[model samples]
Target: MPIDHKQTYDGNNIFARIVRGEIPSKKVLETEHSLAFHDINPLAAIHVLVIPKGPYVSWEDFSANASDAEIADFVRAVGETARIVGAEPQGYRLLANTGKRAGQEVAHLHVHIFGGQPLGGMLAR
Candidate 1:
């Protein structure tokens, strides 16, 4: 446990609260290691967040030590989330902001699934 997992998220971390059942979410899909739900602040017609259940601060942290099973679970959750957002048979953008510089406001590791229309190019400066 190199990083302080407890400090990774405070009580205000909405995803953490959702996972803990402290708050209700439009849960679209889930697995032993991952959970998917609609984004409260949606950027597109269909925007969802796919998050891992482990104590992870960001994508870099999760990818660095995620087991094969954990990685598979995350990816499967992403796929399921895409389907839930109607991004499957069509397409979508998957976003995982790694750090502050990348616009990751939440410490909990999550992948954003957004689509249902012509999305913007990318994160602009």
Candidate 2:
């Protein structure tokens, strides 16, 4: 999907405020490249959001602009966050909503981690 760059990373979005420490969040993990926090509204017993520290509209933006080390660190944070939440043993779902069609409400690039039960499927077979 083609992302609307104008709508991608709005500084007023909640994520941006959280990243700037302007707003409070139930933070779970923070690394040099990423920040992991409990979603204010969770879809599962264990739902967290892992986002890059820098301004990024979507995964494509991050992948295209960030350095190799930054990308690696961000990905590492997601895995580390899952372990902290104890979702590793039972398995978890890591999802990224890219564009409007994918249901990306927030413009900033973030990965949603959900678990605590069998999530079944999101697509029709």
Candidate 3:
């Protein structure tokens, strides 16, 4: 189900469970403020999801509530995850779906790194 950006953060969400070690994920990178892992249902050849450690429902919630250090660390973690996945060489796309309209399936703030081949257009026509 798509998440509502205005809704409160759900601690029991999938990403939260993964963070708590209750759910297993093929981890790609782990930082003080973020966690990167391979997406189980990958959209591309190289698809990864980077999520903040904090309880943020969306990017707006994260930007408004997270500490500066946490924000920086999360951003760096995403970049480092891309580099570690070897997606930086071919360039990549970072996507964060904020609401149901945008197809945000998780109630946690996560950035999807998509690459490893020609991605074509920004959106399907």
Candidate 4:
């Protein structure tokens, strides 16, 4: 686990504010429980991040308190975004970096959905 496991950062804590027009973002999709936006620095042709509208700094924070319904809603939103982004049939990669060692930079819990091209090689890099 990350050293900052005890710390909790809600969507409204920062980034979500940007998405909600409280700040600003290169936004994409928004739902009641989740939000999607293009990665500021993308690693793939279609790199969008799907994040829950909750106060969870990382997956640990979310998993510890989030309900099954919250989890389901997040997945469903990702699936819907995938279809909308044309990564449905071809599929995509959903990446959740749990900690700094795992390459989670932003601190907020988010799943990166990317594909529409070769992904296997990208993972090894």
Give the best candidate by lDDT: 3
- Residue 113's lDDT within candidate 3 is 99
Which lDDT value does model 3 have at 120?
91
Model 1 weakest 10-residue run by lDDT? 1-10
Candidate 2 regions with alpha-carbon error over 4 angstroms: 1-8
lDDT of 4 by residue, 34-72 (tens): 888887889889898888877777888888788888888
What tens-digit string does per-residue lDDT give for candidate 1 at 10-80? Answer: 54577788888899999999799999999998989889999998777777778887888988999988997
| lDDT score of residue 77 within candidate 1 | 88
lDDT of 2 by residue, 7-97 (tens): 6468877888999999999999998889999999898999999999988899888999999988999999999999999999999999998
- Number of clashes recorded per candidate: 0, 0, 0, 1
User: Candidates ranked by TM-score, best first?
Assistant: 3, 2, 1, 4
Supply candidate 2's per-residue lDDT for 19: 91
Cα deviation of 95 in candidate 1 (Å)? 0.7
TM-score preference between candidates 2 and 3, better one:
3
Candidate 3 structure quality by residue, lDDT tens digits, 1-125: 88789998889999999999999999999988899999999989999999999999999999999999999999999999999999999899999999999999999999999999999998876
Question: If both were scored by TM-score, which would come out higher, candidate 1 or candidate 3?
Answer: 3
What residue runs in model 3 are displaced by over 4 Å at the alpha carbon? none
lDDT of prediction 4: 0.78
- Report every candidate's CA lDDT: 0.81, 0.89, 0.95, 0.78
- Model 2, position 28: C-alpha lDDT score: 96
lDDT of 3 at 1: 83
Alpha-carbon TM-score of each model against the true structure = 0.86, 0.91, 0.97, 0.82
